[model samples]
Target: MSESLLAALLALLVVPALLAIHAGDLLLATLTLGGYGFAMALTWAALGAVDVAFTEAVVGAGATTVLMLAALLRTTRRRSPLPGRLRWAALLVVGTVGLALGAVTAALPPWGDPDTPAAVHVSPRYLTSAVAETATPNVVTAVLADYRSYDTLIETVVIVTAGLGCWLLLGPRSR
Candidate 1:
């Protein structure tokens, strides 16, 4: 992708995130978060991680937005105002964390740099040995199901647990 298009997608992510943060109405904030998630999905797609992009679109934009809307339907639309001091303190903490994360990103290797540790060490082994070792034709399948099975299983469990929690909280009362 062209630099301009990628920059625009990244900028799109920031705008909705800021809007969601400042939105007074809970519904508006939820919708804005969905927009942010969609922008994130697009950014991931542009970065050539289609699997991650699709997952983000479905879970982040689709399921999360729907769940928030359902929860809002069960209760209120307007957000309770935070005290001024509390708001300022929260902003300060968030800003500090954001700056720290940005600094960490700056210290990382460049995107897709071939000399990075993963590219230099791990990826070649996976590409060469995955099928033979795991008996899975697709390298990605072998990695996810065989090499990183526990991680994948835990991620699935987390998603399922979150869904179950939402359903228990938002489902109809057992009258």
Candidate 2:
């Protein structure tokens, strides 16, 4: 997609997020969260990350929205207004974090820069020897499942544990 289209898509994504955050109604915020996720999925698809887009559509929008709505149904819809001190404190903290993140991101090399450190140092080894070493046709799968097996295993374990916890807490309640 063109840069203009990407810009428009990002705007769409941000608007829903802002609306969701400011919404006093919990249910409206939850629905807007889903809209934000859908917009984000479209943005990812436009950027050629169809896998990420699919995951966002299912996990970010569908499942998350349903779960949030369920939780909201058990709670009050109108949000309790935040105290002025707490609100200002949160804005200060968020602003500080955002500035720090912006600085770090600005310092990083441009995306897909061939001369970047990771590209120069790590990517070639993966591309050249990953298949031979791991006997996997897909270099990415070989790197994730073989070369970084321990890391991948830990990540899987964490996700599984999180899912289990969510299921135990949020599954159909026994009468």
Candidate 3:
């Protein structure tokens, strides 16, 4: 058989199996999403982007989903019916903001198009100079750790504040 025909046949076979596998319990759905993250990492690796694949495997597949499940366990596990007035107000505000954001996005340049000024101007200098300056292969790490270290420091402060807030709020009340 031709390569295209074989590819099409494989896709046809796999798609239904993928859909069928998710038609189970909530845990199964979460596990499936995690599996999809791993699959995405594999796809990234296949495309010669190993750093992205590693990020997907660690952050997406492992940390994020586990954090989500932990949050779910800490809060109520059952879904609740939406509150009436509050829900309506939230929906209206969200809808208006979403419509405005969508309009702004529609006016923006196309994704990854070489002609876009963003694609041209955003990171070219950083990409070129980062290796020479930082001696780091992962430009993202260099930028985050070195160039934007102040931002990371502020984020760490915010996280520490949040941790303290949670401890104060949820800790045992004094007798």
The CA lDDT of each predicted structure is: 0.88, 0.87, 0.72
TM-score of each: 0.80, 0.76, 0.57
Q: What would the per-residue lDDT of candidate 2 be over residues 1-175, giving only the tens digit for each residue?
A: 7888987887777799999999988889899989999999999999877767888999889999998888888877887886899989999999999999999999999865789888888789989998778888778678778988999899989999998887887678722
Residues forming the 10-long window of minimal summed lDDT in candidate 2: 166-175
- In TM-score terms, which candidate is top? 1
Candidate 3, superposed: residue stretches over 4 Å from native: 1-75, 83-95, 173-175
Question: For all the candidates, what are their Cα RMSDs to the real structure?
Answer: 2.8, 3.3, 6.9
Higher-scoring candidate on TM-score, 1 or 3: 1
User: What pairs collide in candidate 3?
Assistant: none
lDDT by residue (49-114, candidate 1, tens digit) is 887899899988999899889889988998788789998999899999999999999989987688
RMSD of 2: 3.3
Candidates 1 and 3, the one with greater lDDT? 1
> What TM-score number comes out for model 1?
0.80
> Predictions ranked by lDDT, top down?
1, 2, 3
